[model samples]
Target chain A: MSAEMVHTVSPDGPFTSISLAIESAKNGDIIEVNSGTYNEHVIVDKTLNLVGINQPKIDGGGKGTVVLIKAPDVTFKGFHVSGSGESLSVEDTGIVLDSAQGSIIEDNSLDDVLFGIYLKKSSGTIIRNNNIVGKDLPIAVRGDGIRLWYSSDTKILNNTITRARDLVMWWSGDTLVKGNKIEKGRYGLHYMYSNNNVFEDNLFSENYVGGFLMYSNNIKFQNNIFARNQGPATGYGIGFKDLDDIVAKENLFVDNRIGLYMDNSPHSVDSWNTLEDNVIAFNDIGISFMPSIERNIIVSNSFVDNAEQVEVRGGGTLAGNNWFTNGRGNYWSDYVGYDENNDGIGEIPYKSESLFESLIDSYPNLRVFVFSPVAQAIELASDAFPVIKPEPKVTDNYPLMNYKIPQRYEAEEKGFSYKLFVVSLLMVLIPSISYVFIKRKI
Target chain B: MDTKNILLIMKKEAGESLKNRWFVLYTICFSALALLVLLFSTMGGDIAGYSGFGRTAASLINLVLLFIPLIAIITGGVSISNERENGTLPYLLSHPISKNEIFVGKFLGLLITIWFSILLGFGLAGVGVAIIGQQGDISGYLLTVLLSALLAACFLSIGFLVSVYSGKASKAIGISVFLWLFFIILGDLGIMGTTVAMDLGIKQVFALALLNPTEVFKVASVLVLSPRFEILGPVGVYAIRTFGQQGVFYLLFSILIFWTLIPLGYGYLVFTRLRREEK
Candidate 1:
């Protein structure tokens, strides 16, 4: 057994470049690159530790992948990686861990990158504290911030990504994504056929769609804030499709077009997921369910001031789902039920039905008249006559009298916009005062 | 058209309405509704869990489409028919004025009055919202005011057509209400039903949408004001990409102007060419 060698590469050193050092290096060797621009691309094909001192630059000169790790146990840290090719078809990447297992990629700043930190068929990888910003091109051409394909047991943590398409995961299991701040993209965190994952304490804002999980199971999403992700076709805080055994708890979804859209979640079987203690506020629709969606344990969430709190999109029913669990139900902004016993539960079962909404469900085109007098008139009439109203899609037997989520969000800050209130008051006040004065003078 | 006689008839119509306190009442009515719409919009957004000028403007759409047009058409609908019914049209025509001049004068007069009321309504509402709300969705707010004004003008022109076509004031009023129902209320539903029953896609639906001015108004407003048009799915993106956002807007405005000018032109032609029984 031979001892691992240490090589220091510099512009004027024994080894002038990374490729030169890599060619001479053996297995389990450490290559230190000291603070100079490397204009050439390199591929690590063996077990090695690559450390950059004072943040060395790896510029691809606007062409191929900046750094390619083809070996297992390759650890890269503290490099400014950029200048990848703009060809989406070629999958140009800044740093690609291709079939590299147990690799550590940390503290890399990727700028003007096509794809930042791409892990393909890599397992047991750690991607942490990297700042990734894609090109400011249109979303179609711009690349993903962090993409994991067929990678398992990967931990992506504390990465701040902006202006990228998505931090995407596909067919990856036992992956943990935590403490990331993502904004100004299409989808903040997109998952497809990835199960047994944990996502926590991340912030997603101003994206087209915040985060979505599809065709996977046994995922846990907790304590994340999904805010201000709005667009025409897919502006949802968090959307789930055909999933099972998921727990989405203590998340705050605010100011999106649709907060949580469940499309056939629980996956054609008796529901097993738990959606609890989340606060969904200021969305167009708090929860939009596809007609085939059914049977999830939904409880203790606060649904505040959404336009349509619950919309059954293709009109079958949400009747298969459980609106309340353990004698405790969600809190609705429109619920007028009282808690005489002071147990934080409503006295009567809360019915979520209005005639106008039913009309819209039957005829999607009637949505143009959403806030019309006709809709309002029908709602009023339905409220006045319960017999006229059909069965509600969601009925909470013990609706909570107050919001159950302990966390506060940015949406709550809009509640007391005192500056606006004062200005409006002055506007109305001056006119009335002048009118009164003129009358007095007359 | 004789400019001098047109001015004379315009002054006569304007003076008559002013004497009846019609402008004052209409302005006040519009202002009240404007404020009500503002309040309603904000409150509705709060309930839906989102608040912005776009949401507010989007919510007030129904009021602007339904009520603004109703007011405009009603005011314009009786302008000519009432004169004929009161035995004043003969006297006005006897004063060496052409029928085109009379028709154009009455239209310009009523349109100006309605325009003033519309301006006042939007002015009050916009000023109120601008001062009180966050400036995030201000463009959408202003666009709503602009579109609603165009809607009012469109209906006003339709009202003129109905007025000149009918023999009596009562008949004109009846036809105006029916026109309102057909365009504003029934037009949307009929299109939706037909699209569903016939299994029509976006192209057909869009073609049908062009058939009604009200549908044009709704689509234009939704495209501009609401960010939730993504609910239409990929077809929406395809539509925007195909039309180009500005192109659809230009087309809508052109159609609005077309809807305004076509009936008004035909009505003027008929009013001039058709012989009056009394005269």
Candidate 2:
């Protein structure tokens, strides 16, 4: 099978141009292009294997698309795709797979393109192990390392993407994005209007927004690491906005501004998401649930050495074995509590100093005094006098620190019950009232 | 004098409207806003996770209330004023038709055109909502469109009155634009100022806010569509408490009738008086 379809593209024949070689290729063929700079746009419209020997390059001549794949069961490997121009017009991707299925794009390098590889309305594709590095400073460009737009059922794995504006899956569903290293992008792994997608074992480090999930549902992120994503405008390690039914667990967020930010969402149950075992050291706030956020479960997370541990400006259920590091537990580094029990857990829960912390939060300049002796004394006095730390309301008695707990949809069920009660009451009243009047006359 | 002549004049006005650039532009702008309404409404569920009837209705009402007056004032302001400025009103008036017939025919033509635009916008919005699998409250949408159309008619009549009274085209345009802007933006600002000055509670202020036609439409539409969110403000609270659910419908109908008749009646008197003065 290898011998029958082995076609070599070199200086001879129509091999100089990629388009010419692809025109003559058959199913199960290996059209191996040799090392040269071929400035052409190649289209694969058949089920075949296309291999690039010694890293052959396809340049788009800075005008149009480089290569477009419209075939099922096709593989593009070991190529350096380059030369995508900047345009505010319609989408011009370096490599576009439009309506292609079962395609594998692996072990390729995409550089200096508007978009590295865009999968538009395509499904059942595996985009794996590609090194996509955009330009250092984007020239007013709007592109992604690998974008899946209006596509579904694709697996994106182990790809290293950097310097792109956004890594996006827009208006798509049922995707598995795992084991990728995404950095220096505007937003890492932005999911918009997509549903039922699982993102796990990914490292989103040093990005503008280290993962923004919005307008999506039934999406889960687990075992990911978010680190060093700090900028004036670029922060928020994991931000969930207007999302529902999302489950995040066993993730490590260290030294990022606002480790977990949940905003404007309701009916989302976040439980057993371990902000423990994470070095949430040196951030503005560890967890911030804003005013519009409601009905979420924030439990069993450790807040260690952050400027502010937890800022709950919203109404949500905060319960179940969580640890705060303000002298009573979990290593504040300013802890004044003696280990009377010698148990790992502190004897008393920590009482955060309120007025001082509020001042520090509103006026960040006061944070310079955070490590001062005076500040330490104040924190100790506040703890001893007990001015802060709302009383613990335990929802679950024994909360596991590391397990991925499925979010119970009990709230939704209760809401449904109320609706049913109203319906039944109306059903009973309408008929009973009419029957009584008729019976009275009779 | 006859119904056939009135119909002919209405058709002629409609045909003339099709060629008007501003009318075409207005239609496109309205269509765009309708698209935005659909996008926000559809995505609101995924973003907020509480895509109730109230939220959907609130969004639709908010869009209509914001844009309707602007469209109404612009379209209505120029309808008669532009004809007079262009020296075509006298020629049309010289025909055998009575002054009342010409006025009624033109008014009907404009109303029909604006209603057609509103329906087109709503149809597009409906398709978008369906595509996003959002089940919007149809009755709420219909109520909003109807009330908004009435509001538009009121603004149109007001604009036509200005067009009839003003000496120059520029003055008419300026006055119409200023009136719409004042009602929409400045009126809210003024309400906020008065609230602060009087130290009145937000509810009392909102009750006073209903005096502003834009705020009235906004409050009325919200009441009709989303009774649940009606308690968010003083105006809403007072409205629900005073009117109850049935009262809400009654108040809306009353407001609609009042605004519609007052402006059109004024415009009819001014227009008739102006015609006599010209003669």
Candidate 3:
């Protein structure tokens, strides 16, 4: 083959439009697009390298997909793509790769687009260092930030997506999602029927649901931070459904409604899910499990200050799951047992047997009385009368007695404010001074 | 009608309140309790895993809910009945002041005393929180203070009504304590039991809860502390859907104000009729 040629596309170049340059180039040629707006939909049918100088703009003119890749080994980078059509049915996107394998899309900014970057049957694609923002539409109407359908072996790295629906992967296996920050969206990562995916160092905040994994297996979530996903209906840090061999370790679930929601997970009889060393704190409920969920081992996790630590939906005991593995169990904030041996584990087993909490699990509407005197009264009465105390929901034989606050949460605590100190002092001093002055007048 | 007479009576009432041994004892005890609760709740820092200001503020709300009404009701319950028992009401009625002046002056004076004690107690506790507690938003704490004062005023109005109609000071005190129990304990339990047993609808439960001033206070405090009142669950969602966030807050606030004003107004009318009968 001849040496690969370089085609230039600029406002005053031989080829004014990117599509014209692409049509004139061969399969392995490089098209260098200069800094100018190209308002045309460019389709690449052969393998080519499209490089943008000074981040040239590719405006879709509010039409269909801006760039369509139909060949393998395509490299597209350093461009601002915007103004795709706003039809969800049509799947208008900033860039859509169709059956394109071994493609690299990087260092691009997408805005006002329906779907940011979509891959369909595109394997071995790398989407990295890109910023994606959806069109200014309601959450239900907005399109996915990045979606992969039947696209396996894709690596999504160091991307920021905001105000989009979700970063979704359907039937995409062996994918790696890392170092992504997704905020204010519906779901940060929505995975279904994907296997062997690794999610590491991703931060999802202020979204409706942080990560929803369903019908997926062998997924690992490590060192991910899910915070403030307090949606009205379902604010879950991470939800697991009908999955097996999942490992979630060293993750932080904070300030969400339900930290980890499980429903018939580990569906296969021989499979077991593992959740270890995760800090679930300050959520409305630490973990919510379906009545019949089993075959899971939850250990060494810190369940801290959640209003309800573990709630079994529809009012069934959590007897099926194992709370301790290898003589080590989770740390619970409400454990009243003593550590007689000082072995870092409570001598008495930590049991969730709150009568009121059990009642609330059965009838969620009773949650309206949370923190009310009636709730306190029920607790007091149950303590006074053990007969009314229901069976233990779950028991940890070797519950950890002490837990160090995670480094990230500790760093989030700003030091004591002197301004608040002054205000508090004034709140006291003003009343005292006024009282003294009035006393003297009297 | 006379501002000077009202001020004079207010001054006398405030002076008497400050000098009374029981009042002084109650004030010291409340302040010390507030300080202790704050200290205990925030003792171990991060190792204990307390959620900083949010948890401390929740503790303060509970303490205020249980304590403030008791103090206000006791103080206002005896204000008029004790004077009546001592023949001081008749003696004061013979003075140049109208009955309205005495009633309004007494209410304002006791309100000042209650507000001062509560603010001072929580202020001292707040200072401790500011010094050692974990750093988070203290706006919840400030909201607690403001709402506790409103709660105290509401109960004080109820106490005034009890004091006006009771035949004896002891009777007034007994009635005040009973009212406290009814609102704080029995009434809430009844609402919960009835809602569960009768399977009452959400609107009925909401209305029943608002009927008690303390429940209104509790709802308002939770609304401020939890975002979208998520902690309250379905009731909170219903409230948000029925009345937007600000709407629910203002509605609860107006209900508290009504709790304060109606009882105060009714007590004033009763006291006026008593004066006319005396004449």
Candidate 4:
């Protein structure tokens, strides 16, 4: 066994092949691949440091996965991997770390890869700073960006994944996915039957769906941005379905069709989520909740200029949800009520009512009337006659008169500047008055 | 300048128009049409017994924009022209009142008649809706009535313009109908079609929307009533930006008041100058 020996492998080096370098190397040995293209699919069977110098290319010639790490404590880095076989059944991946504990796969560029980096039963592995872009094909043919199956206590960080299907975690627990920019994919981050995951500071933009935590619990999404994740039928910034014990704080969801969509979340009697200080603006529906979503406390957030501030889907109720915490409610752009006493809280409650939202819970066909005059009339009528209206979709008893979404979110917002608006208003009015006067004087 | 003379003239003009049997018929017609609009909404919806008030009021906005201006113009268009043709204009001028007084009195009288028709039409519909179903939006209903009255006043001024300028009632009425057709239907379509064919920007289209008095009413009325008007996208955004929440109220009110006053002023100027020239 070559202990602490450095085997340099290149296309023109003495040990020209990476597999040969690995065969000659021992556990804890280093094999550095220099610049050039290697066409064979390599398997790291020993626990060694397989680092790429000058960014060497590992081409699988459109065959199987380019790199498969089966050993414990293997460190792979800085390789350009491409040309994995296009087979959904085979779960063809550009890189695979199977039960590779204490491993690191960092700063690698994976192109034309089906499954970018698949972690199967791998624990304590760090996958950071990797750029994984899928082939230019239809979404059905594309595979997962980074799929973690039965992988526990993993750190997936700072990876830019685009055109790949989903950054998914299934049956994985205690995962930390942070600082990743996921764009133009199906779901930016999707969790199913996973628990105790924390996704922080990640940007999920232009994906078909931003993120969804399904059948998962004890998740925390902190300070993330979900923007422009639009679809033909369903565009969600973040969705929670049948989950429990979630905390989403200081997140920003902007310009999505549906910003925060929750269904059957906080499922149990004792289950709850604490969402605070988030900024949700300019989405089609700022927050849409399914009926029967209970015990969720959402407070100190700002919902600005959405088509409908809040909506309830499937004719159900958001029971037991606390709109205000500690006497502080979210700021809404459409709230006409003000705090006459100058205490920052509105004197009247802010009602989240829209014609389509009010009716779509019962008649899905009413969604077609969204933003129509008919829907507007119905919404106004519902507000006037509470008896005819269904239960309040979402009411903020202590709504903030001004947006308290923090200064960071304001930079992203095309805020309606009161001063500029007043000036533009004056500019519009002066001409009208003059026109009236001039015509009359004639 | 004389309130007593203006009131006396206003009372006589009001009495003559109010006594007409068509006032009651118009009021009844408005009530039935408003009810039909509400019923259409109810039939379209499957939720509760009645659709929401905002939906009804919003739809009624379109209805009000269409019919009120036409009705007001027809009713007022015949006023001065009919009086002039019947030799009553010379008789009325033989009195001690000024031309301004007669004009103001007739304008106020026509505005009142228009208001009466609107209130009666909408009041009956409001009562009917309240009685049959729950009151969807009483404030919205009232706002509709108020906006509709303003709209009627705006067109009545236009009618007065046609009336004072024309030599006969038939010509005045024809001009009023043409004005109605232009403002209510073809104005928007022509401008929109031309702009689209010319590939004009949203700003141009928005500017064109502000050109017609009725179009201004249409934008402002719906803009104030429903935030859903934001769905108009870029052009709507530009319009909303130009006139913010409170600005829209002022802008539309100014436009309506302008529509009401400017035409009467122009007509008064023409009438007094023509009579002076004849003398």
Candidate 5:
């Protein structure tokens, strides 16, 4: 297919068009590019395919990587790469893949880049369906939208990262991160000392600190969602610092901010993690177990609403099949509780833990008046005068109510279509201009 | 002006506060709070016997009412603006003393180096609670370190009246660190915005948080460490039963003797109005 090996970049080609089609390509050459705006910075080094055709964009003329593959079976399809380098300690990229290998970075879009698809020391990569969009703050060129350093067998699929400060997979290993969506990030799926990973159906919303797992281990999270990660002060939705043999199941965690913050981790296996069939409406604390956490397993979860749900500081072992909607049998929209055998499971079991979470597990800034309503009326008068509930383990006898209720996910109806098209165009032009002034004053 | 020239001007102002480096950084932050209460009481009885001694005397009375008014407003805002920015107060006002013996020898050498750094940080926090607390109570850590060193000598006499009306020494250490963060974080965020605009009434939120001196030093250090927690409702039990106990010890000893006599009588009337405007 020699038209000079199908080169063709825009405005009548050759102003170093895609670096002269990677200096006149060969190993399965294809270039293409065409639709306009190509400020510069190409660098592919061989085993070609570069094809952009209609979405062609490249930019970074503001000096910083826009595309720097280095070589191996490369394939950056449908490009859009934007400006790079904001310096979170430099390593700018829009589509870097240094020390490349069998690459196939698909459907690209990256905007203000520090990194959109970086993969240094690259491996058998497949960073699919990219759409990254960063910039919220601390960006002295800090990036990472689909990063994979010290790479391995990768597959990060269905990407759509937003405001990324980190969507990484460092010290990478066998990765397979599935169905990603990740929003406003500070960390939505950060993987440190990595190993056998496999996060499935990822969503991880409004991040400031969601999905972080340091000192990584044999990972395997399933059916992920993890909503509204409120932040700026050690925020967390699914954090597992100093991690180990991890294995979370049927994950959901709604209204997060310590919805699953386990520190100094140990042999973990939090089974059937179906947390309160989540839509966790408002959070301050739902699940937090610190103090060098140990041999874990908190089965079939659900601890509704959260203003103090389940905080078991230092020392773990809360047996199988969990559920506590907060009233008598979990459903605390501030539970009043009394369901005389209508059997929706409210014959009394709701303790919902608090005494300022046992005085912040023996004082950790007694959580600055733990959201004082006079400290929630002294933790609801010490839950009607009972000194301790620190050891009441009940794991759901019959819990379930509404398992996965969030089905409005096209980015939340595309963020409510401009407020539902300005409230349906003012409800049909204010009732059709008041019936056309009462039929033109008939 | 006599008692042997005010004891030879308080022994040369205690030999320039024992060669001060802010009294050796307040004796190494009171020996690092007595080595963190002797490593949280020798980590025995599993960490201070899991919060005993009235929650470790209410967390050391909130770290001594938040760092003894920040070490008495940074040692009374650099005592007289670093002796008039190192001119050394005009050679200690041209000796032969007597401006009441150089204001009682620089207020007894800054009140004996701030009461000997609060009794060596409460005798090394009572030898770290008698070497790691849990023998029930060391009388609530000796009445919260003697009422937090008498409320850090009434905030070092209101930071020696803002370092004698601040005329540099970096404006008396930036107006005593913004008047100790405006009485500790905008006086508890203006008493939590007047207890959410007076709705959460506990006698108008304890009469507007007892006109905030950090809520009267946290309700007099939780009424001297839990005199059985009815914890001040009814306007903190009517402002401590209408200021009893000899009228709250004569209103905190007349606000610490009017911050040690109105900044040494207005710095001896501004050094006799600058020596009658230099004659």
Candidate 6:
């Protein structure tokens, strides 16, 4: 057997380019490339290690994929990759692992690329600690930061992605996405036909949607923060469609148009989903469910200060979904029920029954009067006259009496603004002093 | 128009309005309510969890919408009818002041009275919020105050129209109360009925909402709080899109200005013609 060798690629070395070094190396050889701009596309078809000594630059010259790894057990890291082609149809990428398995891609910075990393038919891959910025095009025209197609058992960790269309996974299963911060994109994480996936501690903000999981089943999401994904049409912190057997726990959904939007989740009649111990707060609508959504256990969550807490689209009640489990229910900010006998559960059930809100669910145009005195009057009148009270959209018999804010949102408390203080004081003093002066003069 | 006569009547009306019992009571009630809204908005931070200027401003806007127009209409509706019923209008007309001066002077005086009370209410509440060290949006609060004062002026103009049309104070009060109920309930019914009956689009709903001054006030206040129109649902989004952010403010202001001018102008023409007929 031949001994594995280390080949050097430098301006002054035997091989001046990375492709030349790869050509000169064996199947399991190491190619160490020094810090220099290589303005050519390179393809590695053998098992090799490509290590950038001082973070070398791979400039694609706005052409095709900068680096294509077609072999398994390839290690590519410590490089700045840029200048990929702009054609979305051709799927230009900074790094492409085609049918490659067990590859490690880490510590790379990719910018001005259509797709930052494309994993096609690759499994058991680890993509870690990369900063990916997509091309400066229209959001529709922009490509994804990391795209996994037909790839399974991949781990994506701690990568910062921005200004891309989406970090998408298609037909990928058993993927672990953790500690990633995604902002200013279309969909932060777009999942489709993926199963047995786990997402934890991801921060998705300022995108059209934080994460949308569609189809496939048995996914778990925990401690993920979805915030400020306020698109006009699809501003959802997280959404589920045709999904089954999902568990989302201890997640924070805040400041989105709709905190959690569900449509036909737990699709099979025997399947069920669980959403527990989440904080859904300050959104326009919290936990908007489609009419046919059923068989979901939603308990021990905090629904705080949402404009509308439990809205059933298409004008039907959420009686199919269970709001309480084992005498435990979610904490609702607008819950008017009392807890007698020193129990944590409220004696009177928490019922979401606002006549105006129900009308709005049926007729969306009535939302024009939201936050107006007319809406308040309708609610007050309904409270005064129970005969006019509409049926409850949701009922939690053992509603929890207390909620603790998650630490992630608790850390964002802003300090006092002295400017506001001074202005308010002025607002008070100027009017009072002027009123007195005007009266005395009169 | 005699400038000296107008100024003299304005001062006399202002002095009288300042001494009125209802005016004083509304001032106190509005301030107390504003303070309570501010306090509750901040205190609910532990429960509902969001406390800041935005929440306070929204609650204050509702409080202003419910009370400001009622106070303005009641006070302004009876301004002329009370004088006419007590024979003071004839007495004042007997003076050198022309009818034009008296009309403009009364409107300006009553507007100032409304402005004073609104200022005091928002101001005291602002001070309480500030001293408590709660975070708030000062500019938004100020804009709400400005919008509230404009709303008061618009209702005052409508009230003046009612004052001139009605002969007795009791009739004026009845008309004012009825108009108040109509405007408040109009927003609810207009949206509910049109949407339920016809399923009108957002553009049509916004057009209908613009017809009512109360709706305009509510929309403008929401815009101030959330410029992105996130909380207002589709109507706010439509408004922001049709008129740009700055354009919505201008549009609302012009609508309110139109509301104020048309009624006041018609009221002036009718009041002057009626006085001539009486003479």
Q: C-alpha displacement of A415 in model 1, angstroms?
A: 13
* Cα lDDT computed for each candidate against the true fold: 0.79, 0.65, 0.86, 0.77, 0.62, 0.86
Provide the lDDT at B61 for model 1.
75
Best by TM-score: 3
Q: Which portions of model 2 show Cα errors greater than 4 Å? A: A1-4, A265-279, A292-300, A313-339, A360-442, B1-279
TM-score of each: 0.83, 0.50, 0.95, 0.62, 0.37, 0.94
Q: Tell me the deviation in Å of residue A78 in model 4.
A: 0.7
Give per-residue lDDT, candidate 2, residue B26. 67
TM-score of 6: 0.94
Candidate 4 on A1-442: residue-level lDDT in tens? 3349899997788788998898888889999999999988999999999899878999998887889999988999999999999999998899999989889999999999999999988888999999999988799799999999888899999999999999999999998999999999999888899999898989999898899889989999898989878753567999999999999998988767789998888877788898898988767678888766779999998876676778776664554799997788989877889798998999999876554466555544223224433344555667798777766677889999877655454432222334323332443344345434433433
| Interface root-mean-square deviation (Å) of every model | 6.9, 18.7, 3.0, 16.2, 27.7, 3.1
Which window of ten consecutive residues has the lowest lDDT sum in model 3 chain A?
Answer: A405-414
DockQ of all candidate complexes = 0.11, 0.01, 0.50, 0.03, 0.01, 0.48
Show model 5 residue runs off by greater than 4 Å. Answer: A1-29, A32-48, A51-57, A60-74, A77-80, A83-103, A106-125, A128-154, A157-442, B1-34, B37-61, B66-112, B115-211, B214-279
What tens digits encode model 3's per-residue C-alpha lDDT throughout B1-279?
Answer: 888888888877887787678667766787788888777756532421225345556666777788899989988899899888888888888887898999999998888888888878877776876787445456876788889999999999999999998767999999999999999889988887787788877788778888999889988988877755767777778889889999999999999999999999999998987843265
* lDDT of model 2, residue A35: 84
**Tens digits of lDDT, candidate 5, B114-190:** 66666566554554444332343445445555566566666666676676666457887788788777766565555
| Predicted candidate 1 versus true structure: per-residue lDDT over A1-442, tens digit per residue | 5999999998899789999999999989999999999998889998899999999999999998889999999989999998999989988889999999999999988998888889999999999999999987899898899999999999999999999999999999999999999999999988999989999999998999999889999999898889889865679898998888999999988788889988778895754889998988767788988885777888999987777889888654577778897798899987978899999999999888877676567656555445444456567778898898967878899998877555344333233444444543543454345434433433
Rank ordering of all candidates by TM-score, starting from the highest = 3, 6, 1, 4, 2, 5
Indicate the worst ten consecutive residues by lDDT in candidate 4 chain B: B43-52
TM-score of chain B of each: 0.89, 0.89, 0.94, 0.93, 0.34, 0.95
Write down the TM-score for model 2.
0.50
* Complex DockQ, candidate 6: 0.48
Q: Which of the predicted structures, 1 or 3, would earn the higher DockQ when compared with the native?
A: 3
> For each candidate, how many residue pairs have backbone atoms clashing (under 3 Å)?
10, 1, 0, 8, 15, 1
